[model samples]
Target chain A: MAELTCQQCQELAAELALDVLPGRDRAEALAHLDGCAGCRETVAALTATADRLVELLPGAEPSAGFEQRVMTALAPPPPPRARRWRVAVAAAGLAIVLATGGWMLGRASHDLPQPETDAQADVRTVMFAPLTTENRQIGEAYVYPGQPSWVYLALDIDNDTDVPSSTVRCELVRRDGSTVPVGTVPIAKGYRGWGGPAAVDRETLATARLINSNGHTVATAHFRHTRRR
Target chain B: MRGVHLRRRPPERLPDDMLLAGLGAGDAQLALAFVRRFQRTVFGVALAVVGDSGLAEDIAQQAFERAWRHAGLYDPRRGSVQTWLTSIVRHLAVDAVRVRRPAPVDPQDLMSLIATITDTPERRVLAGETSTELRTALAALPPEQARAVVMAAVHGMTAVEIADLEGIPVGTAKSRIRAAMAKLHAALPTPRADHG
Candidate 1:
């Protein structure tokens, strides 16, 4: 409750004159200035200085064609209506691939079996106990490549489901028919299921599967690696 | 001849909002309007700060080009369009001043101009007397302190910015400004002299 020193008042004076103090600090400085004579004097001096500076350095206006240049950089592309049907057709094709999980296998090729209808393979859907009282929903699958023959599998959650607090196991099947259990991840209420990537060569992994702690199949997908064109 | 006639029109009289909207729509005419509107103010502030017509012209051109590229970011909520635009010009002019290191008195021409046209006889007499006293007091200060005070008092730079530009500590900059103010306060004519 002691009087604030001149230095503290000075700092506040400078900051207030510049309009740079945070809200709470500004309020406190103003409250202090209300009763402090020295601080009030300091504020007047600073204001006078600011006014004089403004007078001394009157501003110049900008040049011609300035807005045109700025507008040129900021202008949006022409409306999509000009090419509406073409864009719509492309979007519809992308929607089909996403809905059937056909694109998932294409991305996870190394973990999928090469079937006769390889391009048309559908991901196997397994129903687990309702993830919530509401219902179960499927999420997108993601595959991330890592060094020295490892790939991460991430299944994005599609709904706010109350998943049971438990662990889920994943298995990877090799092209030569050998199988190996991978890591487990917790399936808490808000958790997204991920298996720590299994260390298997690209030539070996042909299929991947997930099962809950109760031994019920939750999801399955095949993988096939394609040669680059 | 057509181009010359078009060039002579004042930019501020143009419909700036329409041009700004056009700019938002990605049209080139907005840039043309923007250049015409602010060119003079930018050049004027630059000349005032740098005190050299040539440097002012160059700085004004650079500042305008930058404002053009960044125009889309302007928000009407904070300040008027002119205020925001002129703030850019002011900062760019200050930069020119820092870089050129021109003699401080050279730029005092603008101040001298302000001193010349007195609105009233009394004001004229007072401004003339104070201007002489102010100059004498300013000349007595150390060059660094004088520059710091002048930049702060004349250009509205914060003490921190002055310190950064001058390569000194904030405390030193603040003290310099305070000392310069004290010197000027002492040199100011007594209140009795005004009554006489």
Candidate 2:
């Protein structure tokens, strides 16, 4: 096809910027634009103004729960294991100064901060464990002891299948088999990353199991019982 | 004063890019804040284009989801978070309206929009200086040009489609759109980098 002349291109700039120019004319104008600087400048300025036009629309509040709904549609989270792996590989690569020990385990320890910082405070660090399904690891759970206690969760939704919208339940099981609910979190795509502010009795949590929305246990992180250690 | 200590700002206080990062990383609180910050603007754009509240809501919701999904790709150098998001919601809204087919844009709706933007102080504030200039310029245009530009820009109507809607020749439709855009372009405080 013959390229559009500069006059033709300039005439089409407004429609091109608006993105309403017909396909053939658009192609010709763009072909002309590739070689013509002046036409390009005109098109660019017009395009910017067209986009800024949307900003001028008056805002209107939608019905309530829209925020909640949008949250439910959040991006796929980076799984706890994935996050640890990232920190691990990054640490291992950066562990040049500390190569006296196994780079792997030392980097893995970075996942837990201040394990012995406040031992006399009566807070326990019963588990900083990875949650795994029957076939492979999918998430990680942290049951760090504190005044109230805290739980951190990282889960990948695609253990063997893709179920990003599945809501995963985190429960801390006690010695008596009674369980405390950490919280129900929605996973998008394959990963979820959440930090601890969940107030629970860390000393009492004997096991951490991730249950899918269907009430079936999907992954479990066996707590390293303090006595067993 | 001795016991006072610095603390991290709340999620609501974080800049737009930070919230978007949190949204991409799937931090629930940040995701909620991101939604809260832009929900009304997204919904309004969607509603204006589609002119159906129910469908607009769906498109708005989908817009958020898409933004979350692709938030990783956002670049600050291209535009502000609001501009990036406005483009997303606008595209989604335009696509939704297009699917409804043969969209006969009401001149009244476009006129009402112009009136709303120029008359409402909050809307002007939301738009900022450059956008406010464009809004005022839009409000100042001849009614035919205002309707023509809006139909093409917001609804993604071609000149032929607009001509059909207004019972005018395609050349007349193009002239109106071109004239309105030239005026709006002149109103911009500074020529912005093109996003398209």
Candidate 3:
């Protein structure tokens, strides 16, 4: 039989000591050890070494309350019946519009005043400006105006890294008595897409506030008419 | 007759996949049974890797919980249940080690203390003479090498996994394991002592 190289024997020794070799490799290594006294001695030493080290490990058992604690942590909370009913009613109402094809897909486009030059117009392009609080930058608030009665408020968030995918509530508050919900912005890419047509009663036309699903004011804009026409 | 006898006989032990299947069925009793069977060994491995009793307990519980949750993912073809569970505990321990900064105890002092404490006849006898010698040898090794051996033997991690966890090259991890093993081999009692 050819002698096993030191490296080959060492690798086998490590594998045998760790008991990590696959069945075939284990068989081959054992075969080699059977005829080779040196290799056999090496394997025996390694095994003894492993066996001894195994005993020094701490033998502390899990506490008696472990299972109960784990179960409690994993247990699902009871359903909120009242809340579910409200949601069911709201869903039923939505189902009607969806069923009847009453879903509105209206789009209103308004061109802002042209800049003095093409460069200025290009520079005047709207981009999300981040809202900063407590020295932590939270999100970018979208700023654009479409009509006097309506404001387009958009927040580009990376939902993947930012928001937890829980139910989020969005609301638009006008300075006047009128308040309207644009709709819940599905958090995508960490940003909340909000702002659609909101009917601002003439009485409450002083200012508008965009509140996110968390009820925090993400952005606010003052009412100033660019053209009275 | 021999072939007939072999065909009729039940396998000596149930496979890990079957055990895990029993666990996943919400068989709390089977789960308890499994825990009872492996708890000491698993805890021992965790304790060896982290070198802390409290951390070992946490690691054991977390490893079991993870096993419970992902039991369905266990494949019998890959390895035994013992190996799989060991791998999980070791991976978690390695991660814990990386995230945790050890207190400023001098490695040499700690090693010396371990050597002295484990050197007693009673301790040696309790662990078996071979184990005592092994522990002493391990304690005498460079901290990194000793850590590598402990992580492999107790936690059941591959050299690659240990290197990745420790942020060292694979070759470095292998060398540490080999060096630690060599030191342990040299430290064993003479063959005469073993026979007697």
**Ranking 1 against 2 by DockQ, winner:** 2
Q: Is candidate 2 or candidate 3 better by DockQ?
A: 2
The docking category that best describes candidate 2 is incorrect
Predicted model with the maximum lDDT: 2
Winner on TM-score between 2 and 3 is 2
The numbered model that scores best in TM-score is 2
Q: Which has the better lDDT: candidate 1, or candidate 3?
A: 3
Per-residue lDDT of model 3, residues A9-104, tens digit only: 657686567654445666777677767777766765576456555555545566677555544432325334444434334433433332232111
Angstrom error at residue B150, model 2:
1.1
- How high is the TM-score of chain A in model 1? 0.34
Clashes per prediction?
A: 33, 2, 10
lDDT by residue for model 1 over A121-199, one digit each (tens)? Answer: 1111110111211123232122222121222343334234434455667676678888777777554433233424345
Badly placed stretches (over 4 Å) of model 1 are: A1-229, B1-18, B21-26, B107-110, B113-150, B153-196
Worst 10 residues of 1 chain A by lDDT: A118-127
Docking quality (DockQ) for each candidate: 0.06, 0.17, 0.08
What is model 2's DockQ versus the real complex?
0.17
